[model samples]
Each structure stands twice: as C-alpha cells, then as structure tokens.
Target: MDRVIYNFDSLSQRQSAATVPLRRSIYRARRVPEPRIGIIYNPRSHRNKGQDLACAGADNAMVAQPRTRDEIAHALAGFAREGIDFLIINGGDGTVRDVLTMGQAVFADRWPAIAVLPKGKTNALNVDLGAPADWSLEAALKAYASGRRILRRPLAVSRVDEDDPAMLGFIFGAGAFTLGIEAGQEAHSLGFFNSLAVGATGAWGVLQALFGTNGNKWRRGTQMDLRYLPGGAPLPRSKYGDPARRSVMLASTLERMPMGIQLFGAPRSGLKVAVLDRPRRRLLAALPAIFMGWRPRWLAEAGFHQLDADAVAIDVAEPVILDGEAFPAGRYRIEQGPELTFISV
Candidate 1:
C-alpha cells in the first residue's frame, strides 16, 4: 500500500478548500515523493521523558533510540550505509553535539539534510533555527518531506594536538563565560531552567564582574593566549586592555542567541568572536549598546573586541563551555564547518 504523505507547507491551503475533491485535486497537482528519513532520539533528554518514540516509525522513516555514544555511532553508520536522505535529531543540545562528533566518520564530505526537535532544557540551537518547543518528530518529518529549509554552519572546536578529537556545536565561551556556566548550573538547581535561568545567570555574572574588586576570579579573569591561524600573528593584547588576561571570550557560528540577544555587532554568517578585557570604567555602559548590536566607534577603545575570523587558537587557563557541556582547558583551534540544511516552516 502506498501511504499518502501530506506536505506540511500546504496544510493550511488544503484545510481551507471547501470539498474533498478539491483537496484531492490540490494534492495530486502538487504531489512530490517522500524522502527517506532517519531519526536519532535520546530518551534521557530533559523534555523527552515519557515521550512516544513509536510515532516516528514510518514506511520511509527509520527511528533509532540509542542509549550510548557507541550505539549512536553505530546507528549513524547503518543510516549512512542505507543512504538516508534526511536525518532528524530528537533530543537536546548535548545529544546533537554527541551525534555530530560521533557521526563525523560516517558522514565525511557528505551530509544529509538535518532537522532538530526542541526537546531540552535550553534549546539554544533550536531557538536560533526558529523551531518551537512543541515541534514534534512527525511534524519535522513532514517538513523534511515538503516544507522550507534554512542552512546553517556549526563551529568545530578541537585540541591543538592532531591526536585529540574535535567537538562540533554552535557556541563556545571561556573566562567569565565559564564562571557564568557554573552559576547557571546553580540556577538550574534552584528550579530556574531554560531562558529565564540563562538571563538571570548572565545578569548576575555581569554584576559580579562590575562591582567585584580587581582580585575577584570572575573580575580578575583568566590567562589566555590567542593566535590567529593561516598566519600565526598574536592577537593584539593591548586592544582589549591587559596583555596577560581577558575577562570574557566567546565564539559562535550562530547569528541570534538565546533571549533574542544580538551579541555581535553585525549579522555575520561564519565564525564570530567577541572578547573583553578586564573591566574598564566604561565597561558597564558599553555592554548595553553591544547587546543591541550597536557598533559604536569607541567599543574597541573601551576594551570590547569583536571580529569575524577564519580560525583562532585559544590557550586558556580554565575550562570552557561548549553548548552546555564543560570542556577541559587546553590549547584549542576553533574553525567553521561545512554548511548543513535544517528544516523550517
């Protein structure tokens, strides 16, 4: 039996049509074949508790709920071998990160279009992709079958050493950003999760960095050495303020961040970076304009540095936050990865 798959894009139009024959005529007029889909679901994700995975099963769709990283790798290998046209991830940020890292071997030089269901505590990537929290796997598969798509690139961070593995995700941060992650964890413990927790923790971090004295860890900042790649010139330390330390450092391939904040001055497509030196007198006032995407002429002179770079080397004194996971401190090379297609509408 050939199952009829409806195009999500035409759902509104089909529903408004007066008669069944008219809907049938529209369907026949615009019918397109469905693509083979593969779903990798993580049951342990925050919002995935007690969720139904059986609904994802279909004639052309394959759903695999993998419990371990090794299982995820194996599933991706099988999907690649089977030649799936689209891949849907049904979990949170950590699940997405793990899949991208483990599936790298199976998807070398070739990637199927991907879609994500926002099922996590903080779906930052999904928020940027404009996927709602209630987005379902069935709806996503339908979207893959016929709806519009948005292409995005992810940031790839790896240890400087060739032997070490690489991690793929949207956001990367250190210095005060690292401390903010710790505070965010505390906020989560107090029943403040999601976007509220993010904003609260961020506001607290900024306040601590402002009023706290020079010796405060969050204020004193971390020691890091940054060198631009392709040409190994050392990044200007004087531009930030203190040559030995920086208060905050962050990089992402995402244009819009959580809480609808525009962290970068301009909407850059690739890897974008923002760095701040130890607090200057005008640091408090400068933050508001920067958050609004304002490109004030004195931003750099006020010890705020933003740039778009092909690659950067970061040797840090502390652990950094990638997505929501904590990565060990080391010398890391950050670069942009290939463009990936994501479902929308």
Candidate 2:
C-alpha cells in the first residue's frame, strides 16, 4: 500500500556521505565545558549509521541508542532521575518525535532544555532552529553553556476514543500531504533529501493531479470530518464543493519549512494550517505562487483555506503523516503541546 508509513528494509538502507550535498562544513566551537546532557542517538538516521557521534569524550555526556519505545522511555527516566541539565536528540524528525512522545511521560512539566543535531532524512525542526546539517554536539554544548536558547511547542495529537496521552510532534498532515511524504521516501531512496526531495516530490504529485484522468486519488480527495475543537462547528464548505473532502490538509508549528514552503501565508507561531477543498483546474497555474506562500485575495473563495488554529477535531478514513510517519484512520484531536527550550547557537 502506498500509504503504509515505512518499510523495514528502507530503515537500514545506507548512502555514501559524499552523495548528500546539503552541507559538508562542520560547525565547530572553541573548547567549552560540557554540562550534564543525556544523548539519545539514533544509529539509523541518514548521516549517523556508520559514524559514531563524537560526544563520548565529554565527561558529562551520556549516550543511549534505544531501538524501541520502552527503551526510549527507560533512557529518559534515567536522565530525569539523574537530573541532567540538557537533553541532546541526535537524530532527525522521527527520532525527535519518538523522544518527545516518550519523554513526556518521564518529564511531565519540568522539561530539560534540548539541543538537536539534525541527522534525519527530513530535518524540518532543525531548519526552523537554524541548525545546519553539520551541527555538532560540541557546538550545541558551547551554545548551551553560553545560555542561548529558543522555545517551541510541539503538536499534541490524541484519538478521541482512546485513553492514551497525546502523541507529540512538530508537523502533522493528512490527505494529499500523506501522498507527498510517500513520494518523499522514494526521493530519499534516490539520494535526494531536504529541499531537493521536497521539491521533486511536490512537483511529481502536482503534475500527476493536473494531467491524470478524472476521479484520480489526488483529484478525488479524502473523506474527512473536520471541525474546530471545543466548538464542534465545521469549517465552511467551499463554493459548490463537498464539505467533507479535501485535496490537501497540512499543519505545522515551524516558522520556516524545507524549500521555503509555507502554505499558511506567513511566518507566525502556533498551529498554522492549509486545507484545500479538492483541486480545481484553476489551481494548476497558481501552484508556483501557492508554494511560495503567496495568497491572492480571491483564494479563500476558491477553496484554499489557511487557518491559525488553536485545536481541531479530525475524522478521516485515510492515514495521516506526523513528521515522517503515519497513523491509522480514526477520530483524532490535534492541539498545541508543551513548550520546550532549545539551544539555537
């Protein structure tokens, strides 16, 4: 199935370091004393497979390579018990999502400051934090000791029917957005990543919808019952379009995305959303401006809806992608999650 989140074979796939052209210059810092930091390293991230993270030299640095949720929670619990001052996430979006999701149970309120070494296939969070592809633990430790940091809140998603606590992440999307990620995985296999992968996948998806026959998956859209949370009112249906069908629905907490894409209009905080009520013929030509964050005055009337959301209730029969992973179809509540401080230097 195209919508299936991941393939195990792909998880262990390896690519030569020279092939990825994002950034090769390593960010270094002068000698700085390390603080008590627990490092959750993902050996499976794109850049971290064969190379060991070089933080073992620091006296206060502790590293854990956890392969399961239980192990992640256990590691975080140990960190919390030891009262580490800084927590370093040494992977990309998926690893970061896993840490935040499991760490919530271990650090409920008094969360430790985090520093991410963006080594994932898609490092959107790192892009927002201005962390380059070569950002290192040494640089992060220097920034931390210098007291430089920024705050960001993750998106908390919970099924309305389940008793489980909300899953925390930075990006969330369903419908066509899910398709885009599926294409992105293929792009990654071809040795393209970050902005190039994002652009290629997006172009492929758009071209398919534009040239494909009627009733295609992209054109048909997904059946979703979306309404604002705590209010229970539906978003107004577009002119002559089905109220429950949307071609694209994406939400994010980041100010800047890969390839400089921002469907939510401008760079602002909180949950910014973009939902399109199915694709139309007129939309084909406007793709360039739309991807560039341009919003025409008549766009809202044509079914392109941008929302600054507090919370939303979603009921759909298709899988939704959070970060780079997928969740099954069901009724879900999406809201702002806990605020966390991160070192930005």
Candidate 3:
C-alpha cells in the first residue's frame, strides 16, 4: 500500500484563499458608472407632500409617485424592467417597508444599492444608516455616484407557514408596543413625531401600565412565546420571572435606533431582541436607564432579557407592529434577511 502525505499548511492556505470574500474587491471605492437610478416617492409622506424632487436634472434617474400599495408594486416592476442600478426611497419608514415588501420579487437574489431621503414622519432606518434628516434626493444621487457604501441586512418577518409574502423592515414590536402605537398616533395628531413622539408614547405606556392596574390592556399585555429557531438556541430565562410571557417584546436589526435611544444596550447587529417579563414598579423607574442602554443587576432581576440571535419563533396572539405598520396577530418567524447595500451620505 502506497501512502501519500499532504502538506496541511498548504491545504489550509488554499482553503482560506478560496473562502476570501469577494466583497473585499467588489466593494472597492470607485465611481458608479452612469448609474440608472429609480426614485420611489410617496407624495403623502410627511416631508415629501409639498416638496418637489431635487434631482430632476439627473437624466439617469426616473421618478415614480405611487399612492396605493398595488401602484407601489407596479412602479417597482417598471423600475426593474428599466434595469435600475440604484434605488432611492423618498419617504419615511413605512414607505421603505412598502418598497421592500413590494419589490422583493423584482430584486430577487440581488438588490440594487439603495439610498433613503429622510422624508417620512419617522425615519429610523435613516438614523441607523447615518443618513441625516436633511438627506435630500440630490444628496442621495450624489452619494450613489460617489460615496461610502454600507451593507445592511434588514429583518424579515414571515408567518410560520411561509405561505404569504414576508415583511422586511428594521424594527418590530409587540405586546405593549401595540398599545403604545395607538397612543403615539394621538401624539402624532398633536404634532409630536419622531423621537419626541416615541418618548411621549413610551412615557404614557409606562404610566398606563403602572397606574392602570392588572386588568388594563396595556398592563395586561398579551400572551407570546419566544423560542430560538434554527441556528439559535433557547435563550436563558431569568429565574425570577415566568419563562413564557413577556410584557414588552421588541426586536430589530438596527444598531442605533431613532432619536439616539439605545434600546438594545450595545446591540450586536443581526437580530437583537429585548423581552421584558412584565414591568414592576422598580422596572418602571429603571426604564430611562434601560432606554439609555444601562443594564443594571436590578433590571435583570426584574426580568429584562436581551440577546442577539439569528432567528426566533414568536408565537403571538396579538397584533404586531413592523416598521410602523400594523400586522395581524399570529405565529411568525423573525430572521435576518438578504444583505442590502446603502449609499451613505
């Protein structure tokens, strides 16, 4: 029997080179060449209602105003048909969600580099991507032509059955969040929006939960179970609290949330989740600290749980919010979706 010996070092070097990510070279800083850009403008968006697009002179771009959801899907299909290399979303978070949802088929397998004009009532995605509130269509176009590209993977939530279209977004909330959003709407009607609205709504929610007693809907919360899905393990539960239900359940792929609030306390990308097993008086007092990302021993004692995972199964029977939109109550799987490149300002 003839024996052959292979050099382990050589084999390792070959394997490493084969796995060297193409992104190192493919994403090298360079001018985008005659990019075909598509702008999906929502005329009803708070800031975009009266403002004309600033990049009208850019012949390489095509603008579409889509009012209805079906119109949005049609507009995206048209843009895809034109072979757009870049897409600029001009609206708030909800509009962005609409684009991502409707255009999923058009951008299957690969998505064009995207840019966002912070023209919505709540531009949380813009905040995370460092696109300031003043990010304009012209600036977005300029960035698309020459600017740093940020690669982000938005969270995708789908029903457990996987029979329906999935929703792609940065933030998701349930339980108390659904109640809070109702209050936030009242705040919005009063001209409070963005971070201020969030603070107000959260404060109101805390008050309701604390003073409304156990039977109050906000305080009563809803029944939900979070289990680690494939590629993740069941997270550790605090010994002091029930392992099944949570009072506040929220998750996101964003590192920096809207209004500079650190909800995850040093979030580690992917899908980071925070589940509070109902709030006690002490937990209510510590919420400001929690919002500031300060995790204290007392908070953990009160059942504050945060973790980063690849996927989670949420068996929820209450309405859920995805990027500011309401979704019907049901069991769903939340996970990190495809990588999307953004043209940073």
Error of 1 at 41 (Å): 0.9
Model 1 / residue 92 / CA error / Å: 1.5
Estimate every model's Cα lDDT from 0 to 1: 0.75, 0.78, 0.75
- Which residue pairs in model 3 clash with each other? none
Candidate whose TM-score is highest: 2
Kindly report which residue stretches of model 1 are placed more than 4 angstroms away from their true locations once superposed: 1-32, 54-60, 239-241
Q: On residues 162-181, what C-alpha lDDT tens digit does candidate 2 reach at each position?
A: 66667789888989888888
Clashes of each: 0, 0, 0
Task: Write model 1 residue lDDT over 42-80, tens digit each, in one string.
Answer: 998878888777564466677899986667877887787
lDDT score for candidate 3 against the true structure: 0.75
The number of the candidate with the highest lDDT is 2
* Residue-wise C-alpha lDDT for candidate 3, range 194-234, written one tens digit per residue: 77888888889888877887777876657887889885466
lDDT of 2 at 274: 81
User: Which residue pairs show collisions in model 2?
Assistant: none
The alpha-carbon lDDT assigned to residue 277 of candidate 2 equals: 86
RMSD of 1: 12.2
Screening candidate 1 with a backbone cut-off below 3 angstroms (N, C-alpha, C), the clashing residue pairs are: none
